[model samples]
Target: MAEKGRPRAFDRAAALRRAMVTFWELGYEGTKLTDLTAAMGINSASLYNTFGSKERLYREAVALYDRTAGSATNRALRGAPTARAAVEAMLRGNVDTFADPETPSGCMIVLSATNCSHQNRKVAEHLAEWRRTSVAELEKRLERAVEEGELEPGTDVAAIAAFYATILHGLSIEARDGVPLERLRSTVDHAVALWDSLVRQPAGRG
Candidate 1:
């Protein structure tokens, strides 16, 4: 057999972006090698050579998603004025990102490999860790809000963070199921209003 020719120098980052979108649209189990190769516009040998294996490729794709589509929530969390505003921004950002016409509808970490078999349990675990980190960050922000007199002193920061985290996960699922952006934005507004009602008052005030 003849030796294979030199592998073409296609754009690695561009290929990864394509892979990220593919994984976002189709869960790990739902995606196939052929689908990946086709989406990446690379042949099987090049795909294997560039990304090692399908599992590794999926992992890399998720990381890319974290830095790209999955980044809007983090940006909103950091950029908003108050803790409640931050949470609202995060949820609203999720709606815009998930509902964008350019990319897939759901979150890459949440919808990808969510319920795999034992052999692929590690993938699920990996995604779960990302969620745990996000929740922890939100809790830290909520706690800071309490310290800074933005939130009620008695507020349960952990519980509040957990509640919103759950809400974001549900929103991901709903967005994937074709929920309209306007409805999701309405939900975010309502959630933030709930937070506003529970906000801290000045000392000695009613």
Candidate 2:
């Protein structure tokens, strides 16, 4: 029998990061196989053997993003002392992240599969599900805020979460379209200020 091919030696973690950045910049369908190989500093055969397939690699890359960007988002929501403060921090933090000089603009999840061919429809659906998860998390946080009396007892927490989610996703698109960081920050400030009108602070409180 013929001898089996030998496994290639490489840093898997480092290679995955390079692939993640490629997908972050180019998206699922836009990212070419050659681009992944070039950025990863590996041959095509090596890449396929190591990553199994492009779709699988994309999923892994998104998971990496969840650990980094998604974790930071959750922190911004949960770390603050109040619901409004948490959302303010989350939105403001998104502005900073999308505008950071060190990485591609916009979000990987939002930009990665905005539009894809039918063959890649699954990828787009996968990203949409991730967005839904985010919306659900925000809804839960807002619901808790209602229970804690930070928001009006009759507040429609789900609707509030959807409103913020829409704004956050719009910010991602604007970042990708070259909207300036300062402008985005101004928008975030305005959005946060809306909380004053929405929340039901205790009597005699600001």
Candidate 3:
């Protein structure tokens, strides 16, 4: 059923990127197949052939978003000079981007989970798994800080990581609600200060 001379050269990555923005703007339930096909610049059969189904395509789009945006937090956490700096960078970067008025779409995971029913369980599970991985990664970094004497040996790394992770979810919600960048920055600042206070000082300090 191929068109006479129309070549079949769909850019899979580019299509997924477009799909990501569409889904980010319109939640799972709100986005129709027609909307997705138009956004992706493909026909129904082509879209289905390329991505399998709407649900499958949505999952791929979420995965793409996760790799681009969510992975930035992971990279920041791993690249910073200190554990505190890493955590601060991760939290601050997320809020800064999420609160940007220039960002055409809101937080995809947050919007999807709130608007979609259990039919979108795969998307929900993907987001949940990403959060769990983030928290665990932070906990490991905190543990490393303790071993390096940057944090108290008795510090509850798991608890602190969980606390910060919860704060991140709140920030995502705030961003979705269109909170101002300054307010989001202030919130992150307060959270960073609280985190700083928990650092373990060197022994025999004044």
Candidate 4:
């Protein structure tokens, strides 16, 4: 309970963001109440009053991470000049950011999906839904490319989308494993080359 004279002036959103990053780095099982409070700069009572419990706070944090990270990927997907370019750029951005030494925490969604227990089904389901949405968006982009003559009409859009999704998942693992940045870049370049091979040129025009 906070003192009557000293009001709780904490920024709730900012605190949740901090908590998101903390849990992202340490994981649910590893994160302690003290750790969260310290990172959030709020006392235990304030935290409980605001968020109810650690699990509830974690759920909020996960939602925040999903929105923030998903928006970034969505922006990259929409901003690319072409479908192939969009996929390449999105995957490259993910690899680069995840592998950056300055990125004190790796990907939150990936961490949760891989580490959280069966009891945390909601978290797992959220991550799976996000992945499905990503794949669907990629398929839409690929279909657009087909309509624009960028890919052959017969190209398998669903397969291409799945391939890119797999690449993104692999990059997340590599980042968690502390793979060297140079190696990750090389791998991304290879992935781009593979994706390029699938693009369909104008019919009868080489």
**Highest lDDT against the true fold, candidate:** 2
Q: Write the per-residue lDDT of candidate 2 for residues 1-206, one digit (tens) a residue.
A: 44588656789999999999999999899899999999998998988888899999999999998788645568877788888887888898887888887899998988899899998899999999989998898888988888887787767777677778888999988998889999999889888888766554433343
Q: After superposition, how far is residue 173 of candidate 1 from its true place, in Å?
A: 0.9
Backbone clash count, each prediction separately = 0, 0, 0, 0
| Candidate 3 wrong stretches, greater than 4 Å | 1-7, 199-206
Rank order (by TM-score, best first): 2, 1, 3, 4
Provide TM-scores for the models. Answer: 0.90, 0.91, 0.86, 0.84
**For model 1, how does the per-residue alpha-carbon lDDT over 89-158 read when each residue is reduced to its tens digit?**
8888887887898888878888988889999999899999998999999888888888988877877777
| Candidate scoring better on TM-score of 1 and 3 | 1
The candidate, 1 or 4, that scores higher on lDDT is 1
lDDT of 3 by residue, 35-144 (tens): 99898888988888888998888888877877786565777777987889988998888887677665543467655656447777766777677668878999999889
Which lDDT values do the candidates have, in the order given? 0.84, 0.85, 0.78, 0.78
lDDT of 4: 0.78
Worst 10 residues of 1 by lDDT: 197-206
Pairs that collide in candidate 3 are none
